[model samples]
Target: MSVVSMLTPGISMNSFEATAHVVTQLEVQRVSYMLVGALSSNAYGIPRATKDADIVVSFDSIGVVEFAKSLGVGFKLDRQMRMETITNSIRNIITYTPTNFDIELFRLSQDEHHKERFQRRQRRWLEEIKREAWIPSAEDVVIQKLRWKRRKDLDDAENILAVRAKKLDWDYLNHWTMIHNTNDLLKQLRDECPNLDVLDEE
Candidate 1:
């Protein structure tokens, strides 16, 4: 469902507003984070509405609970942290009281690609948030989505390949996909998208 449709009616805060508020809170807490999930995919691929915002955070200075508490009114942080099965990362959910929208904060994991992707994240102007925010590179988004291989994720990866064909760093993409055992899937996506030129410039 679209973010607007998912929001509670008569609420002043829309999905972008709720996401912006959560991002502002993270900035206030001085947490290092990168926007991910549907939002990240939307930046590179076809635009699609999302009900919630997902972020990967490095909580170097403060504990998770304390950070959530600091969000103060209009936000409630779940005390119970859960393991995300696909990535096996710990995540906490924060509910925006006004709109009942969820903001998922995934603790940065020690996985090799996770660390590399965070390091490679780029700052882009987010018109919705009215500020520059960190987001994964298009190649990383493609790699991660292919690794996940869910129906939606595969669709997202294919869309990204379709839209960002010429600009992609094929060598870097090939290396990681091979390491993650997603090279075949990547190849399949590329093959399926007839408009994507098979030749790599780099």
Candidate 2:
């Protein structure tokens, strides 16, 4: 199934509208990051809402310090600190404001698999006056949410599961989960949300 098959109408317009503006600005400014997390998934029609937009970029080239300083030029940053850069790593959330959306920017890590995912990511959607793209695919999005291990992240994942259930490429989802060592979490989710299995698989 295609990405568009997953989302129903009106489930995520507000968030996308807000995201489009920021991404447009970034592209215009020649910033080199791709949006990830919920917004990314939602763009691919996963149907989930996120409080803020999460982005991953080649911060090694740009450097987190320089990126932070650049962001300060037009944003009111909330918190800025370093965080792991990979699946099991931590990186800082350089959150900012005034775009009516929270922007969480992070540098890509040196992990080979993480780097591969970054390189293979699909463009979020066709051009919309904003040269925007989302990093993690649907399956990866599920895996990351599970890794977070937060109640809210879990809930969000469940929502994605429900909405995208019909269109989910289970084989692909399983592949990424296993690669990321998140099979246990997928099992946990399957056990916790009994209805998940009943979802119409596209």
lDDT per model vs. reference: 0.82, 0.58
> Would you list the clashing residue pairs of candidate 1?
none
lDDT of 1 by residue, 1-202 (tens): 1112233323567657767666666776778999999889988877777788899999988888887776556778888989987677899998887778889999889888888999999987666655667899999999999888899999999888888889999999999999989999999998887555543222
Worst 10 residues of 2 by lDDT: 1-10
| Residue 166 alpha-carbon offset, candidate 2, angstroms | 4.6
For residues 68-149, write the lDDT of model 2, one tens digit per residue. Answer: 5543333444454656634543445543343355666666676655676676677656333234455676666676777677
Model 1 spans > 4 angstroms off = 1-12, 197-202
TM for candidate 2 is 0.64
